[model samples]
Target: MRKQRDIIKQLTDRELNVQLIISQFSLVFLSIILSYILFDSFVDWLNYFKLSYYDIVYYGAASGLLIVIIDLVFMYIFPKKYYDDGGINQRIFRDRSVGGIFLLALLVAIAEELLFRGVIQTTFGYLVASIVFALIHFRYLKKPVLFVSILFVSFYIGYIFVLTENLLVTIMAHFIIDFTLGLVIRFQKRGANNE
Candidate 1:
């Protein structure tokens, strides 16, 4: 653990960002390949993307708005217990432009949803998928509140996908949550620096 922490500490912001991007894309690619091998059909694993534009728009908007609201409520209730670790703050908000943050969040959302909801949830059901989702977020392990919150969010995302049979909804929700939180943290840090 000490060695791992030291390694993480040594990573520069740009290196960290690059690592994150690579990891997300790797997850996406690996999930697709594994899903095809196990299910023998990409369409079987990725059926959630088959929807009309109107349905996609409606479900995506609704899911995103709902998740944002829930996240805000949780943050309000336990401000200090949220993603208060300086590591996440630095990785997400510090030395990053707004567009870069949004793009990073978008990629992360797509990759995570594809692996967790698109393939895992479709195969293993919601409970197992949610658990796997929360487990992969190792940072949350040290923060109990954040861990529980993430578990709930994962479950909710799975539920939304199951209900609507549209991966776009969960992807949109995940993107909105990450993007909004990144912007909020970035501006808050900037404001603090200004003061």
Candidate 2:
């Protein structure tokens, strides 16, 4: 664990790193299925807990919007620099077409919404679950301020997920936040390397 963290730190930039490609695919499938396996109980818990529909909708929409706004700020502040070969514009738009961006995005949208928002979070409650979410990302990020910022955003997203009991809102929020940020971050790296 220490060694891996060290390697990750030395890296100039972060890209999607899969632990095991086949295993990750398998896990995504299995996790989604597992999430649905408990759907009935989850719904029952939601009602039993007496969560208001309005609360759910309001938090879900608000958090989603908040994350998007933050992401856009980051993008503008740190615009991505990408492949000069395809030209930065093409790298941002056209290059993605050649890859599995759409499919991967869809898969991530489904799996993450189901597993993170739908299942574990529902099972654990927001405050506790958000802590876990923050912890999961902790090792990759160590700066106190940055880590706290990310955690706050993650917790906010978790809060909305619990409030709404609607995966669509969380997934859309996560998708927009991640895609815009990830694209810019990636482009920034490529952009920087170009110079």
Candidate 3:
């Protein structure tokens, strides 16, 4: 696997095809992490938000952790189909180092939830921002079924976050889903090697 710096360099400077995939996934993962962090921190920074026991247990801890476990299982069981692994085990868990990536993921997820679900949807009163959020998802996903599915999921997540008025829940849900997708490819490779 390319060093994170090299991958970033290729996208910003080299514009290499190989680098494009890494760059795309990395950027997405990074964004999610940042969103989550900001979502949690910004509210606290302003003394406007705090995670309640309900939020922590139902949204952050339970939903997020459970989703991660389920997704991880699916990912390992069906790698070729589920995740965009790019045939790299490192992409799944990367032996080199994950300090930077893990940190970024958390931050991005927090910030993003704050913006997309907690702040955007809630502030806009769900209907308006939910439509906008669903529409934006169109660019990333092509299939009609997938697009609609994501739209519905987005709405559900937004609603839950709004109901709870906590970004932590949204971030947890998002992280669990995304992290599982990333793990899919690794599972595939592992099974192949064993066979």
Candidate 4:
């Protein structure tokens, strides 16, 4: 954990953003490749993106807002140290504009949902997808609370996917959580700076 902290502290903001871009795009590419290998046809893969369930969008958005509220409550209740992730997340969003934050969050939500929920869960099962999702967030592994939180979040998103059977729903849910938190991080740092 100390090593991770030291390494992250050494990275420039550009380096972090570059790495995030590469990794997220890699996930998107992997989703495409995996879908190609797994599905019977392109059409079958396309079918996975069903957006006809308009009413479920509310459920997904509400789920996301609910999670964000719960997380904010947790942050208030817990020591700041418990929520720290080597300052990586702070570095990622603190300097970004609102538009930048929204774009980054959307990209992440889509890329992750495309691979984790759209491809992996659809192919294997919810449990497998959820486990894999948690594992990929390796930085959080050393932090017990963050690790457990990711597990809970992953499973919750997986449940949303299961209930809605729509990739867009999970993507929207993921985006809302990330975008809202990114804004919080952005303004929180600004407020700290002012203080």
Quantify all predictions' global Cα lDDT against the true fold. Answer: 0.80, 0.55, 0.54, 0.89
Best by TM-score: 4
Which residue segments of model 1 deviate by more than 4 Å? 3-6, 79-82
1-195: candidate 3 lDDT, tens digit per residue: 654434533342224434534544565565446545655554443332456777757866576666556545544676433443233324424321244335434654665565566555644567876777677654325445445545765776776666676666677776665554444434545677889
- Model 1 Cα lDDT, one tens digit per residue, 44-91: 766668666665566666666677787777778886746555466555
Cα lDDT of model 2 by residue, 147-191, tens digit:
665687778778667556666666666665556544554566568
- Tens-digit lDDT track for model 4 on 62-162? 88999999999989998999999988789889999999999999999999999999899999999999999999889899888888888999999999888
| Model 4 accuracy (lDDT, Cα) | 0.89
TM-score of candidate 4 versus the correct structure, residues matched by position: 0.94
Q: What is the lDDT, from 0 to 100, of the residue 35 in candidate 2?
A: 55
Candidate 4 Cα RMSD (Å): 1.7
Give candidate 3 regions above 4 Å deviation. 1-48, 65-101
lDDT of the structure predicted as candidate 3: 0.54
Candidate 3 local Cα displacement, residue 115, angstroms: 1.3
Query: Rank order by TM-score, top first?
Result: 4, 1, 2, 3
Better candidate number, 1 or 3, judged by TM-score = 1
